[model samples]
Target: MQLFAYLESFPILHIFELLELTLAIMIKRLLFEEAEITAREFKIVAITGPRQSGKTTLCKHVFKNKHYVSFEDLDILEEADSSPRSFINKYKDGAVFDEIQRVPGLFNYLQTHVDKVGKNNQYVISGSNNFLLQQNISQSLAGRAAYIELLPLSLLELQEHWGNTKNPVFFMMNGFYPSIIAKQSSAERWLPNYLKTYIERDVRMIRNIENLNLFSKFVKLAAARSGQILNVNNLANETGVDNKTISAWISVLESSYIVYRLQPYYNSFNKRVIKSPKLYFYDVGLLCNILGLNSERAIKQSNMYGAIFENLVISEIKKNRFNKSQYGEMYFLRDSTGNEVDLVLEKDGNLIPVEIKSSAKYRSSDLKNLKWFQRLYRIKGGMLINQSTENQELEDGIMNIGWAEVANV
Candidate 1:
């Protein structure tokens, strides 16, 4: 087939080719909320997230009328590197450069160019990995840019796309990747593809690991230990990977927004406290898949039930804090002496302690650690989250609510 004939054969494909950014997603309303914040006063809006999380699509949608280009294309990357000023001149004005970190030096050029040559919304840059992109942009576009992160689509965002559902089981199994939800496919099919592609793309782009097969196994091992107090040495010993490699790989995961670490609260107390951070998979569905739990039935019968509950409670609360106008912080209470609470929430100078139980039957025993935390923090009230019938405030004055209300908790 001739070149023009091949192009003519698929006219529709060329007619409207999307850049695979935010607009290709159904969570536009949620992303719009994020865009509104960035568009406020900052000269540069750098939207960063893991690969395949829709950074490019959203930016194009927001900057549809502006000059749009992607550094993912090698030619443009070379053009920006060889002649940045010419690249700027080429794009008349207000330009959106997708995956701009492909050429870090270009940010230095934009810092001055956007000011002298263009208007408020003149330039937008996107990057997949912050490990390399952070230092580049900081040295160049530090104060001039307004930055926001785009993690895997949130539950509320997914709710906007799929409407509402009563399936906590669905989230635990499928996780909330945008492509998986927007297209609305079965968890069994998409989760495997998601893992294979995500590992192949992100792991190679950020670092040069000699053994990718080992690194892949490491991801699965890390998933099994989600929502637990992580001991780096222990993990390294189990995976047969050195402690340094484990630490570096975990940092890669953080920059990619695949997992998060919550630090323990430190206070002035005689009882020694464990200062180590706890680990959590940002997407519970991905975590479950990594653990090899196939379905809702598998999850319900697993020994990881307590840990899953912990992940649910912590993630839901963290999501709530981020979604609101005010920012709220999450903490866990644990001491060297061995007294611990499953989750701790700190906001507006107050400490709220919560304990999670796997059972539906209620008892004061469930609130033991919360009661202990209350004495130290003067907590407004303690909470015991359980899987049960109704939400109640116990006679001891602690709020005990069913864990099923995690969405509202």
Candidate 2:
């Protein structure tokens, strides 16, 4: 609010001066267009993401005309839980429901109401818990609701306001959480509390875990394993838990949007590829916090620097894809002998292998895997995302683009 007030208080002459220099523009989420389009096509639209990712803010901004209701209020939850039909009827015209997963049974009443009315855009619902929200959607609003996954700010979204002066490593350490970035707060101070709340609230709501300490340790251990192939047995040994428990915790992490498990590309061409999936954090800043790296110097000098950079690139690409409403499959390719492509993006029925390197200088040897994968699969093009400032074309139709340029693709 202060940010807006400060902008409004700026002299009108200065505002026009900034506009003439093409420096003034509205700071908005790229997913706004996708959500607005979905609202027009479906009777119910569901926005889901991690806690404090600005889902509620985006919903309120897009559906401002609709009456806003949040289940976080105990009174509203009580009313909805007791009389689901009445709650539905009260907002028969249209409404935006925040944290709808809090009352799963309400979805049934919503389904009946929308069916009777046979109208589009009757309700917009959002929740942070994907497991519970998706379960309710599958049971009640299967064909009626369109889904959108919103992550934190991507580089493209941030460049709208901050420009391109910041580097990839800078974001890798501080992350793209909107509230922290907007307030210019220290990630070290904010992310720990955010992680604590997620563990205390969302995890308990999702599954019964008697040992919060053990679960917290499991999360930190998983963070240390970012950008590496997931090993359930190793994690079990390290966390003093069984493989089953480790697997379950990983599922909980993914469902809560704390981590992502990138499955390996198994479509082999006369070679045995690694079948295990790679683990990556949804936000690298959270990963850094979990590892106790509070400073840029600590992050750059840590042994996990390469892993952090890799996670940053992959997660940024993932966020950009979601922002653009691209729901395509993305995977990593690794063979038995350790030849691998960091990422494989599925678009238009073709697999484009991508090589991710933390090096600032381009080298021909880095493109070896990209060329090999292209020739083996008979693919025409591939991408190499690195820290370089320049873009160039290499052998075998492969293009080397800077990390910030991922938003464009």
Candidate 3:
């Protein structure tokens, strides 16, 4: 029988199962395309991202025919730890090593193996802790490995896999972790557990913190301050820790991919720009969880609604750029005089200033900062990203893009 006829002949429940399975296989990750291209040019490819950000799934999916081994297996880790050379020899044909940070010594052996073989795409390595993975790469696998960051699912990926919906508010509140979408799990249950696992295990492994409670408090405080300029002194006072300590903790969070700091854009013409970097969480769902926002209604009514919206847009831009194998430098343009542009994307010598808003209505004042930025920089175009559904060209070069259409912009 033909495929459609055969599927139709199955019971209703069975058809649903078949459809789910098909979708599970058909879902293509944005990074997977670039990863495959990188693998062809490098001896080794290292995929690093936050834990549970679909690193394992992306690597496996892209290199489906390759042998796979995970260092997370205690016995395998012990074996690899004891005899790195021997363990590497066993996968001489090439293999995917998941969580290779757990086996740091293996990098030296892999380096030797790749040096002798001199083959492209001979080994695929993945890790959740970028600091450890990057250190190992720099020390042992430099000039041999192609580093690719796989952040959480982008809005484009979500739209491609799951049909686009009108309710972006729901997505912003829930965030875009792959497993949460694949399993249709509740963010309330998943995010808390994710936070606990990351804090109790990953943080401990990365740093030696005496008081978990204090670290947890610091994380929450940082989340509360998301989208605001990072002030180490203020954070130190709020957390009751020294500025140096606060800086160290924030570094740990940044290295672990928990948060990202958007540096301010300063030019000769704009000498008044603030030098401080702005803080934003990599995942808004985790931010919401940290802030104890349990429902969509709460998020909508909260005073931080605009900041959270800005955070989502900025992160999406970052993810989209990374997925395309482009290291687009993103910054916020703000001056001491209080003139600010929410996001400034610098690519190919052109600066694209983006202004973000949570409201559906577009006002002339919304583009005030963008227009000023254009005049100062002598730029022809900019964008105003907001919740409005329609895309409009409000002026000669200023375009008002809706939140859903941000990926395309």
Candidate 4:
């Protein structure tokens, strides 16, 4: 059965009926659409993302007929690590290899097999550690495999699954990890363990960190500074580490797909644009956990509420574009004169400035940065994504878009 259908077969109580239905609908992810399109052309396909983001589930659901093996099983991993050729021979027809990064040596053998067969859609590989998986891919599987990144679920996908009743604060607090949503688990209970596993497994595998506690502190500090321009020196001082170590740790976070940096937009017209990139987590629920905000009410009242909301909208835009198999050319705009826009999406020579506001109340002044960007760049239009329920066309090719309808924008 499909993942969602399998979940639906459980006997749900009357009180839990609505949530169960929502989970059932969410089983149909946007990445499946991208996977189907990619499978037709590539001899091997790889899906990379953070753990529990549903990489394995996606490959299994989309390639139901393919034999499946997971490297997490130590016996299988040992065999593949010891003798990759024999392992590949065992799955000649094709197979989905979960956590393929565990056995990087297998890539070379798989490459040889696929080249010999000259077959399309011969293998599906999934890994949570992008640094290792991508490095191995470049060294061995380049030009032989297609790649897709599957992040936590998108707001649009959640809306399609649950309808319009979900509060924005709820999404901000809970985030979009599929397991948390599908099983109706509390983020507080789940995210701490998730962080522990990430630090203990992926972090150690990526780099040698003698002090795991210090690394955990750095992660929390990074979360505290989410949505702000990255300052490695400051982070280093706070964590009592050298600047280079701080940089390397941040790279670990990024390569593991735990955090992303939004590069600042630069144009000849504005020489004073900020050059530093802003930091953001892939899932707000994880951010909330790092911040110790357990409930929706807590999230709404927290000091970082606006920043977290902005993070969610920015992440949604990225996820939406990625799901459609489009490269995301997203940036943030800020100048020394204090003009700033939350997100600047550049595509095909057209610039779309998006302003994010946490309040439901919309005012003309809320779009000041967007208007300033349009004027400076001579861009025809911009978007204001806020909590307003109605969409409105404001002055000067600017539109006030409700947060729920951001996918349409």
Candidate 5:
């Protein structure tokens, strides 16, 4: 297949390219280490989320005491692929298997080992591609696996290491992918190369993309459409590919952690549930690059301000979800009608509904959906997050908070 067709050619490399895999990953230490404790409690820790979202880094970071073996290391994968049990036995007491999806059969063997040992965090298993990884894990590990989402650096984690800045707008404009935060000499070349390399490696790894050009076009089109309700047919028409391929390509981007789909949330007494999902890029800077967004001035003047704000909102929710140290447990809410809240935090079935707005000025109308949905679902309460200067209690029973405040809390 001509799947490699989509990888744009570039003749340069950044210094960070050589250093990314072993740069001492400052954010790893700053990230929620206490969060990994939950996975340790489970029989097998299944770390997932988008590519370069740092799944491998987190595994390496947490399993400092455990021997490390990467399937991408060729020899290790050959061992696991040829002799799953023996491959595992070599690790003996235990080890970290990075990108275990490359050797799916080993999971069952690992599960057996954990069962025999009777639990105590026997294995630290992580995969960048979740769609197939989850399927194999469910088939092999199931209840034995504890899955955690390792997304791109969260705003809160960034602030911790990078230090807090006065510019909320700047952060919102660039967003949080670790490489961008590294302050490399040339994010210009770095960003595009990163996207291209990711497209070639992770995107092609999932499915054989015969029409790489179409796939590349799909990325550009998707970037331009960020923050809008995703229309598969429209995307299909634009890309000259079937909706199935478009959908699959989008899934590839999502699985690679390049973009995320924000499923809408709401229930006007079962009146306004939207079926179509809204898509957002994992990082604003990447989206901006694909869409040709060059300057902070340009992002500010662009019409996507509201959508970018909403993207920031969801990204923060994802960060905190991981921040809590819980594994594989974050989702949005919506029904059949159009009444919608931006995000939903569903834990233990409590249904914490959240809303996000870009304007510092928040109004009662902003939280109407949340209030209505909360009353109907009997949720804990509706949380209204925005660019407000300070966290305050609104008279109308809503919690008005700055985006940053809500992210850490």
Candidate 6:
């Protein structure tokens, strides 16, 4: 039951060596380029993502000259709430407003200041709750604000230490959170506390759920269903809650960036194609903890290993896509008769199919759905992602790429 003790059994990562390798992450993020461009062009640039994904750090790094004020401080939040105009005037030169969603009414004041000044890069805002942040932005600063989504570290972002050779399972268990990867922090020690805080603070802020214990149960149950088609009715039954409550809780999780729903790609490919979206956690290490897979051996022996592996590959690819400012372009293909491709990426006028498998042994049969889908669509190239270290080209245009190289694809 002791999560930290169980995690300590994994292969030790030398702290000194890891610090040397992870220096690149501390120095730069893939989103820095996009954030910089947005800040230059837009009067207000908003960086939003799950908490501790490094929004504050990235904002400070990108806008070093700007004064930073956190609204998480109760006194500061009260001041902004009571005297929005004066608060805005106090930071008239410009400031990074961290956790801006806490003072929703302050956005109108921000709008006024930015308009009168008529200068770009005058204000930068960030928050963890996407729904509240975007709602405030749409109501007040729609055209003036440009948004950037920052997920956990992508595989490509951490390529210096973990790109080609490390086992995908290791990263899956350790996770890709900035502190965990950049500081060699213990996932076991950190994630439990993070989850508790999210349930206590974010869930309360988003919506009033009378029972925190029930909500916690719903989240763990949801984690168990990761990488599978979401069946709300069944989940509601299992959680002893109505479908409507289950649906609302899911929205809270999605808005807070705890989990994401990967929609099913539908086309003329089949009329009976499954339309429900599949669920996935934004960070695999958190998913592992929720499922009580504290040790590496437990992770490998558990039946969910394959699903966890699939989640890692898909989430990394998503981070890569979002880092480039692309949104709503990823999906999975599954039909009534057991035809499924792990991931389907919609590119510029083309559908790039990707298959994920956890086994290292190359099985010709594992490529069945990928091959079938490509031929049916008359697509020329595809990728078979697996646990292999050596990237190789197979018959046709499909390539077997290691999981660590997922973000690159």
Question: lDDT tens string, model 6, 38-61?
Answer: 888999999999998878778777
What does candidate 3's lDDT look like per residue over 1-409, in tens digits? Answer: 6998888889986664455444346677777778888999999999999987878777767898888788889999999999999999999999999999999899999999999998798999999999889998999999999989988878887778667744766766688886676664688899999999989998888888888899999999999899999999999999989999999899889888999999998877667889999999999888988999879999988899899999988998888888876656999988888999999998887899999999998999998899889888887889999989999998848889899997765
Using lDDT as the measure, name the better of candidate 2 and candidate 5.
2
Model 2, 1-409: lDDT tens digits are 9866876988976553333222112567888888889999999999999987878777767787999899999999999999999999999998999999999889999999999999898999999999999999999999999999989888888877777649766786788887667654578788999999999989999999989999999998999899999999999999999999998889899998999999988864555899999999999989999999888899889999888988988898898888887768999988888789999999888898999888899998999999889877887789998989999988878899998888787
Displacement of the residue 90 alpha carbon in candidate 3, Å: 1.0
What would the per-residue lDDT of candidate 5 be over residues 1-409, giving only the tens digit for each residue?
3533422242234233434544436655344365367655787777787666666666666677888788888877787899987877888787787888988777778878888889577787878888878889888888887777777777776666667644556765455666666655344565777778877777777888877777889999998788778999999998898988888888888877788887655445655566678788877767777777667787788798777777767766676766666444444565555566777776665666677888888887887788777677765566788888788877446688887786564
Better of 2 and 4 by TM-score: 4
Off by over 4 Å in 4: 1-26
Stretch of 10 with least lDDT, candidate 3: 16-25
Off by over 4 Å in 1: 1-28, 117-119, 159-163, 395-397
Where does the lowest 10-residue lDDT sum fall in candidate 1? 14-23
lDDT of 4 at 10: 67
Question: Considering summed lDDT, which 10 consecutive residues are worst modelled in model 5?
Answer: 6-15
Tell me the lDDT of model 5 at 203.
74
Better of 3 and 4 by lDDT: 3
Clashes of each: 7, 0, 0, 0, 10, 0
Residue 292, candidate 6: Cα error in Å is 0.4
lDDT of each: 0.74, 0.87, 0.87, 0.86, 0.72, 0.87
Q: Candidate 3, which segments miss by more than 4 Å at Cα?
A: 1-24
- Candidate 5 residue pairs in backbone clash: 35-325, 50-257, 51-256, 265-333, 271-337, 272-337, 272-338, 273-335, 273-336, 273-337
Model 6 segments more than 4 A misplaced: 1-27, 161-165, 326-328
Off by over 4 Å in 2: 1-25, 268-271
lDDT of 1 by residue, 1-409 (tens): 6855755765563423442343364366355566756765677787777766666667767777777788877888898899987887787466777877678777766777777754566677788877667777778877777776666666555555667544566678877666566554577787777778767877787787778789888898898888878899988998898999899999988877778899888877634878889999877877888888878899999999779867866776666555453466788888877789888877677777888887888876787788788777665586788777689888557888876565565
TM-score each candidate: 0.88, 0.92, 0.93, 0.93, 0.81, 0.92
